[model samples]
Target chain A: MRFIHTSDWHLGRTLHNQSLLDEQAQMLETLLALIETHEVDALVIAGDIFDRSVPPAAAVSLLDAFLDKVIQQLKVSVIAIGGNHDGQERLAFGARQMARAGLYIQGPVSASISPVRVDGKHGAAFFYPIPYAEPALVRHLLEDESIQSHQDAMAALLSKVQAHNSNGLPKIVVSHCFLDGGSESDSERPLSIGGADKITPALFTPFDYAALGHLHGPQYKGAEHVRYSGSPLKYSFSEQHQNKSVTLVDMVPAKAPDIRLLPIKPQRDVRIIEGHLDTLLAQGAKDPGRDDYLMVRLLDTHAILEPMAKLRAVYPNVLHLERTGLMQERSMEGPGRERMQKSELTMFEDFFNQVQGESLSGPQKALMSDLIASLHREAGQ
Target chain B: MRFIHTSDWHLGRTLHNQSLLDEQAQMLETLLALIETHEVDALVIAGDIFDRSVPPAAAVSLLDAFLDKVIQQLKVSVIAIGGNHDGQERLAFGARQMARAGLYIQGPVSASISPVRVDGKHGAAFFYPIPYAEPALVRHLLEDESIQSHQDAMAALLSKVQAHNSNGLPKIVVSHCFLDGGSESDSERPLSIGGADKITPALFTPFDYAALGHLHGPQYKGAEHVRYSGSPLKYSFSEQHQNKSVTLVDMVPAKAPDIRLLPIKPQRDVRIIEGHLDTLLAQGAKDPGRDDYLMVRLLDTHAILEPMAKLRAVYPNVLHLERTGLMQERSMEGPGRERMQKSELTMFEDFFNQVQGESLSGPQKALMSDLIASLHREAGQ
Candidate 1:
C-alpha cells in the first residue's frame, strides 16, 4: 500500500493581513493532482488544517473544495488529525461518520487507540491516527496525576498503544507532534523545549512508520520510519527556497520502504528578491511567474512610496515587502513618545533608584520635584 | 426515505450565562435513538449547530461526539448546512470529504443545487442543503451588483436548484432560515424585520420537503413543505412549556407524509414556580424533580436573604430567579430646597418651564447659580 503524507495546511494564514487564499488554493490543487498522478491510496494530513481556530470563511471554502476533490472526486482515503492551531472539536466533528467512507479524522488526544487498517498484498497495515497531545492532557488521561513533561506524555501514549496491539501488523502512526532531531523552521510552532511534552526519539520505538505533521519541514528522527511530510506550500520566505512536496511511501515486503518526494507546483511562486525598489519591480514585471506570491526585500537607500501598490501592478500577489537598509534611518526617528508620559519614566526611575539604594544630586532632586509637581497638577485637572 | 429533521442545536448556547450544553446533549442523544428506532435513513441538521461563530472548545467536542454516534454507530446519513448564527465557511470546512461518508454539508448558497441522493427501496430522494445566505453575498455571487434582500437571494437559490434538477428526483431542501408566517420565539436571532434579509415563505415553492432551522419552534409557513423543525432542547424559559422534539417524517408514495413528533427527555427539566420566598423554598425542596433546572419567581414582600443559596440547595440547576414584587417607600426627610438642587426632578421642571416660556422663581435662580458655581469650582480644582 502506498500513501501521500502531508500536514499543517494552515489554510487561512495571512502574512500581516495579506490574503493567502489564492496561493493556498493553487498549492492544495497541485497536491491533489500529485495524488491522482501518484495513485496514492491514502492522504495523511497530520494537523493544523487551518491557520486559526476560527478560520476565515474563504479559507474554509477553499479547504472544503480541496477535501471534496481529494476524497469524492479522486476516491482516496484521507487520514487527518487536529493540530494545536486547530480547534479540536471542530475538526473532530463528523469524524466518526466520515471514517466509514475512508476519510478518517482523529481530533482530540485520547487514551483509546484508533487504528485504520488498510489491506495490502502481504496482509494489512494498521495506521494509528494520533492528534497533537499536550502533556497535561496526557497526565489527565493516564490518571497518574504526577506526569508533567512531554517525555512522560509520550511514554504514556506509546505504552497505551503497545498494550492495545492485539495483532502485530505493520503499523503506521500519523501524528501532529514536535520530535527530537528534526530541523526547526520559522513557520513550525514550538510546543515545548524542556517540559513534560518534549518527547525524544526513544518514545516512538513501537511504530513501523511514523507519518508526523506540525513541523513544516520534511525530515525524519531516530529511524527511517519516522518522517514529517512537511507543508504542501512554502509558508515563509525562509521556506521560499525549500522544495515543498508530499511524501509518497510504498510499503511492501523484501524492500526497505520506497519513499519519494512529490513536488507541489505553486499557483504562484514565492520569490524573495533583494534589490532597490525600482529594480525589484522591474524584475517582477518582466518575470513570467509574477502572477505568483512574492516577498521583496528593499535594499533601497531611502523608503519607497507605495511599494506594494507599485509591485502589485505586475505581481498582484505581492504579499510581503520589507525594507532592509532603510531600517537604520527609520530607527533614528524612533517610536512615537506620546504613548509614554514623563511621569511614567519618573516612576520607573524612582523605583530603580530605591532598588539600587541611590541618592539623588541637588539638580536631579529639583528636576524630579518639578516632574512630580506637574504630574500632581495634571491629576487634579 | 424516512428521516428525523432537527436544527438549531446551539450545543454550547448560553441564556444570560446559563449553560444549556448538558440539556442539549441529552436531547440530541434522544433524537438519535429515535432515528434508530424509527429506522430513519438520513438525519437532517438544518443549521446553527453552534450559537457563536467561534464556538468554545466544549461545544465543538459535543457536536463531534454526536456526529460520531450518528454517522458511525447508527449508519445514518446527515445533511447539515450553516445558519445565520454559524460562520458558513468554518462549518463547511472538510464537508466535501465528509460527504463521501454520506455526511452532506452545504454552506455556500451558490452551491445549493449540489444534492446528496439517498436511494431507498421506495425511490431516490435528493437532499439539497441551502445554508443561510446573506444578501451582500448573494449580490457578489450572482454578479447582479444591485440585488438585495434574502427573499431575492433565496429566489436566486431556488432557480439554481430548479435548473440543476435534470434527474427530477424527489427533492428535500434543508435550509437554515426564517420565513413569513413563521412564529418566532425570543431565542431566534432576527436577521431583519422587513429589511434586506427578511425572507418570505413564497420563495420555497419547489421542494417536496423543507426541513428548516432557526425560529426555535415547529411552524408551517403557508406551504406544508416549508416547516421549521425547531430546537431539540428548551433554550430559554420562554420555551420551557414547549414540547421539544425531533420531527420524524415517513416519505411514502401515494400517501401524504406522516409526521410524528418524537419527544426528547430533557437533561434537566425546567419548572417555573411562583410563591413567597419561604413557601417557594419549602415547595421547591419537596418537589420530586428538584434535580431539574428551575426558574423560581419569589413573590416576597421584601428582598429575601440569600434566596439563590436557599433554592440552590434543592435545585442545583436553579438558573433563573426573580423578585416578583417589591416596592420602596419614598424618603421625605431632606430639606426641600437642598433636595431639589440635587434632583433630576428639578432639572425636568426647568426644562418644562423653559418649554412653557415660564420665568424661574428668584429662589430657583439663586439655587441654579449656586449649583453652577459649585460645578465650576470642582472642575477648576
Candidate 2:
C-alpha cells in the first residue's frame, strides 16, 4: 500500500497581513500533480485544515474546490482529522455523508476507535486516525480521571486502537501532535505552555508507519518510520530556512515501510536581507527581488528618510523593515523614566529623537517652548 | 403529491436580547411531527434559513440535527433556496455532494434551472428552485443587460422554467422574494427601502403551485396556490398578533392544488399589555405571567421607581417596559437644549423632579446647591 502524507494546510492564513490564498491554491495544484504522478492510493491529512476555527468565506470555497477535484475527480480516498486550530464540530458536520465519497473526517476522540480498512496488494491496510482533542475531553470520554496531559490521552487512545486491531494487518497511525525532539517554529501554536503536551515516538510500536503533524519542519524521530510532512508554505520568518515537503510512504505486510520526501516550491519565497540603505538599494537595482516577500533590516546607524517607501520602489512585496542594530542597543538601556520627569520640552525632544532618529531643530525647539508657556498660562487661569 | 412549505426560519434569532434557540428547537420538533402526520413527500424551505449570513455554532448544530432526522431517518426530500440575508457562496458549498442525500440547496440563480422530479401517486411532481439573486447577478448570469429590477429577474427565471417543461407535470415553484400586496412586519427585513423588489403574483401563472418566503405573515396573494407560509415563530413585537403556521399543499396533475395551514405553537408566547403601573403590578401578582415573554406599557402620568425590576419580580420574562403617557407628553415639548440655559441649581431641581416625580426636600435642595458650588470651584482650579 502506498499513500501520500501531508498536513497543516492552514487555509486562510495571512503573513504580515498579506493573504496567502493565491500561493496556497498554487501549492494544491502541485500536490494534485504529484498524486497523479506517484499513483498513490490514499491521502492522509493529519490536522489543522484551517488557520482559525471560523475561516473567511473565500477559504471555505477554496477547500471545497480542492476536495472536489481530489475526491471526485481523482477518485482517491482521503483521511483527515481536526487539529487544535480547527473547530471539531464544524469539521465533523457532514462526515457520515461525505464518507460515501471516500472522504473520512474524524473530529473527536471516541471510546471505540474504527479504522478505515483499504484493500491493498499486500492485504488489507488499516488507517487509524486520532484527531486533536484536549485532555479534559479525553478524560471525560474515557471516564478516566488519570488522563491529565496530552501524553496520557494519546496513551489511552493507542490502547483502544491496540485492542481493536486483532487481525494484525499492516497498520498506520495518523495523528496531530507535537512529538518529542521535533523542531518548533514561531507560527505553530504550542499545544501547551510548558512541554507537557509532547508525546514519545515509542507509542506507535505496533504500527508500521506514523504520519505526524504540528511542527513546521519536515523531519523524523530516532527511527525513519515516523515523520512530519510539515506545512507546504512558509508561514513566518522563522521558517524561511526550512524546506517544505510532503512524505510518501510505501508499506507492505510484515516489513518496514519506505518513506520519501517530495519538496514543494512556493509561488513566492520568503527571504530576509540585511545591509545599509545605499548598498541594499544598489543590490535591489541589480537583482530586483520583486517577486519574493521580503524582510529587510537596515544596518546604518543614522536615520534614513522613508526607507520603507524607498525600498518598496524596487521590492514591491517587502513586508517588514527595522533598524536592528539601533534597536538592540536601545533594548540594553534601562527605562527612560528619569528623563521623562524633566521639563515637558525636554521630554518632547527625547521622544522626537527616539522615534525619528534625529534631534529637534532650533526652530522646532522654539515652537515647543512657546506651546509650553501657553499651557502654563492656561493652567494658572 | 403532498409537501410542507416553510421559510424564514431565522435560526439563531434573538428577541429583546433573549435567545430564542429553545423556542426554535421546540418549533422544529412540532414541524417534524407535522411532516410525519401529514405524510408529506417533500419539505420546501424558501429562504433565510439563518438570521445572519454567519450563524453561531449552536444554530448550525440545530439545522444539522433537523436535516439528519428529515433526510436520513424519515427519507423525505428537502428543496431550499437562499434569501437576501444569506451568503450565497457559503450556502452553495457542498451542494452537489449533498444532493445525493436528497437535500437540494440553490444559492445563485442560473440560466438552466433543473427540476428535482419525484414520482407521486397522481403523476411526476417537478420542483424547480429559484434562489434569491440580485438584478446584477441575474443580468450577468443570463448575459442580458436589460434586466434591472427584481421583477425582471423573476420573469427571466420563470420563462426558463416554462421552456424546460416539455411534458405535462405537476410543477411547483419555490422562491424567496417580496411579492405584491403581502403585509410587512418589523422583523422582516425590507427587500428594498421603497418596495422596488415587489414582484407581481402573475409571474407564477405557469406553475401549479408557488411556495414563497420572505414575508413573516402566513397569507396568500390573490390566489390560494401562491402563498407565503411565514416564519414558524413570531420574531418581533409587531408580529405578536400573527398565528405562526406552515403551509401544506396537495397537488395532482393538471389541476389546482389544495392548500392547508398547520398552526405551530411556540414554547413561549410573546405578548404586549398596557395599564397603569399599580394595576399591571396587581395583575401580574395574580396571573404571574412567568411563562410568557411580555412587553409592558405604563400609562401612569408620573415616573415610577424601577418599574422593570418590579414587574420582573412577578413576571420573570418581562423583557421591556415604557412610560408611554409621560414620554409622549415630553416629546410634545420642544428640544431640551432651551431648558439647559437656566441656572445650574434650577436645572438640577427640574431634573430631580422629573425623575423622582416630586420636588426635593429642604435638606436635599441645600445639599444639591453645595455640591454645585464645589463643582464650580474644581473647574476653576
Candidate 3:
C-alpha cells in the first residue's frame, strides 16, 4: 500500500501582505500529480488544512477542489485531521457521512479515536488519526487529569488508540503536533503560541508509522518511522534553504515501510540575496529568476536613495529589504532597539512629528493612544 | 411528496451587534421538530444560508449540526442554494458527492440548471434549484447579452429549465430573488444590494410551484404556488408584525400543490414598545418578556439621563431605543437631515469640538479626516 503524507497546507497564507493563493493552488496541482505518479492508495493530511479558523471562501474553494479530485475523481481514500490552525468542529462537519465515501476526517477530540480501517492489496491497515486539541479539553474528554501538556495530551490519546490494535495489521498514526526534538522555522509560532512541550515520538511504538505535522520542515523525530512530510512551499524567508517535499510511504503488512521524499515543482522559488545595492540591482537585471520571491539584504554603507523603488523595478517580487554589514548595528541597534521598546502611539507620534514638524496635540494623542491600544488588544487575541 | 421550504436564515447575523447564533441554533432545532413530526421527504433551503460570504465558525458549526440531523439522521433530501449573501462557489463544495447523500447544493450559477429527480410514493418529482447569482454573470454564462435585469435574467434561466420539463412529473423551481410585487422590510437590503429589478413571478410559469426567498414575509407574489417561505426569525423591527413560518408543499404529479404554513415556536419574541421614560421603565420591570429583544420608543419630551442603561437594568435584552410624539420632527428633521448631508469627518469634527471645547488643529483634522475617510471607503464596500 502506498500513502502520501502531507500537512500544514496553511491555505490562505500571505507573505509580506502579498497573496500566496496562486502559489498555493499551484502546489495542490503538484500534489495531484504526485498522487497519480506515486500510485498512492490513501492520502494523509495531518492538519492545518486552513491558515485560519475561519478561512477565506477562496481558500475553502481551493481545498474543496483539491479534495474533490482526490476523493471523487481519483477515487482515493483520504484520512485528514484537525490541526492547531483548523477549526476542529468545523473541519469535521461531514466526518460521519463522508467516511462511507472513503473520506475520513477526525473532528473534535474524543476519548477514543476509532481506527479507520482501509484494506489494500496486501492487507487491511488501521489508521488512528489524533486531531489537535487543547490539553484541558483532552483531559476533560479522557477523564484523566494527567494530561497536563501537549506531550501528555498526545500520550493519553495514543493510549486510548492502542486499545483497538488487536487486528495485527500495519497500523499508522496520523497527527499534528511539535515533537520534543522537532526543529522550528520562522513561520511557526513559538512555544507560547504553539505550546511546544516534550511530545516524544516514543508514544507511537504501538504503530508501524507515524505521519506528523506542525513543523514546516520535514524530518523524523527520534525515529525514522515517525516523520513529518513538511509544508509543500516555503512559508517564511528562513525556509528558503530548506528542500520542501511530500512524504511517500510504501508499505506491506508486518514490514518496515519504504519512505521516500518526493519533490514538488513550485512555480516560483523563494530566494534571499546579500550584496551591495548597486551590485544586486545589476545582478537582478541579468538574473533568470528575477520574478522569484526575494528578500534582498543590502551591504551598502552609506544611505542609498530610493533603494526599494530601484530594486522593485529590477526584481518585481522583492518582498523584503534590509541593510546589513556596515548598516547592521546602526539599523538594528541604538535607535531601532529604543524604537522597538516604544508603544505604537509613540512611534506614530514620532512619525507625525517628523512629517508635520509639530508634536501631536493632547486630543490627538488621546485618539492615537486609544486606537493603538485597541489594535494591540485585538492583535493579542 | 412533502417538501419543507425555508430560506434567508441569515445565520451569523447580529441584531444591533447582539449575537443571534443562539437563537439561530434554537430555530434549527425547532426545524428539526417540524421535519420529524411532519415527516418531510425533502428540504428546500432556497438561499441566504449565511448572512455573509465568510461566516463565523460558530455559524458553520450550527448549520452543520442542523443539516447533519436532517440529511444523515432523519435521512431527508435537502436541496439548498447559494444566495446573494452566500459565497456561491464556497457553498457548492462537494455538490456532486453530497448529492448521493441527498444534499444537493447549487454552487455558482450555471448556463442551464439540471433538475434533481427524487422519487416519492406519488412517483418521481423534479426539483430545479436556480441559486442566487448576478445578472451579468448569468448573461455571460448563458452567452445571452439580452439578460440585463433580474427579470430578464430569470426569464433567460427559466427558458432553459423549461426544456427539461417534458417528463411531465411535478416540477418546482427554488430560487432567491426580489420579485417585482413583493412587500419588503427594513432588515432586507435595498435594491442596490439585493438587485430588485422587476423579477416578476410570471417567470416561474413552467413549474408547478416556486419556492422563493429574499423577502422576509411568507407570501405568494403572483400565484399561490409561487410563495416565499420567509425568514424563520424576525430580523428587524419592521418584521415584528409579520408571522414567521416554514412552507410545507404537498405535491402530486398533475395535481395542485397544497401549501401549508408550518409554525416554529421561537424562544423569545421581538418587541417594540413606546411610553414615557419612567413609565416604560416601570412597565419593563413588570413585563413578562423583559428578557426578549426590545426596541423602546420614549414619548417623553425631555432628555432622559442614561436611558439605555436604566432600561437595560430592568430589561436585560433591550436592543434599541428611540423617541416619538414630541421628539419626532426634532429627532428626524433639521439637524438629522443636516447630519446626514455632512461628511462623517465633519460630524466627527463637530462632536470633537463640542466634547473637547476646542476645534481640531490642522494636522489633527487631517488625521481625523484620513481615518474617517478610510472607514467610509471600507463601509461603503
Predicted model with the maximum TM-score: 2
Error of 2 at B347 (Å): 16
Q: On a 0 to 100 scale, what is the lDDT of residue A69 in model 2?
A: 81
Model 3, span B286-309: residue lDDT tens = 788889888988886544456789
Which ranges of candidate 1 are over 4 A from the true structure?
Answer: A119-124, A143-148, A159-169, A193-197, A202-208, A265-381, B115-128, B135-148, B152-173, B195-209, B221-226, B289-298, B301-315, B318-324, B327-381
Could you tell me the TM-score of chain A in candidate 2?
Answer: 0.86
Say which prediction, candidate 2 or candidate 3, comes out ahead on lDDT: 2
B1-381 per-residue lDDT for model 1 (tens digits): 888898988877886577888777777778777877888888898999889888887888788777767777888888888888887677766776677677787766773368788875446688878888888888888887557777777788777777766375667888887777677777888887654555787777556788899988776786766778888877777887788878888776655567888877786776677877777667766778888777877765433447799888867778888766532111342655444344434454446564666756788777776876587567663
Q: Best to worst by TM-score, what's the order? A: 2, 3, 1
**Candidate 1 structure quality by residue, lDDT tens digits, A302-355:** 434566888788778777888776664445543544223343444445564655
Kindly list the per-residue Cα lDDT of model 3 for residues A195-249, writing each as its tens digit: 4555877887557899988899989977788898889899999999889999999
Winning candidate number (lDDT): 2
The whole-model C-alpha lDDT of candidate 1 against the native structure comes to: 0.75
User: For model 1, what is the alpha-carbon lDDT of residue B332?
Assistant: 41
**Clashing pairs for predicted structure model 3, backbone only:** none
Q: Over 4 Å off in model 3, which ranges? A: A191-196, A277-286, A312-314, A325-381, B191-196, B276-290, B300-314, B325-381
Task: Tell me the tens digit of each residue's lDDT in model 2 across A74-184.
Answer: 777788988888876666655655666777888766776868887643345888899998898899999999999999999999887777754877778889998888899
Positional deviation of residue B298's Cα in model 1 after best superposition, in angstroms: 4.3
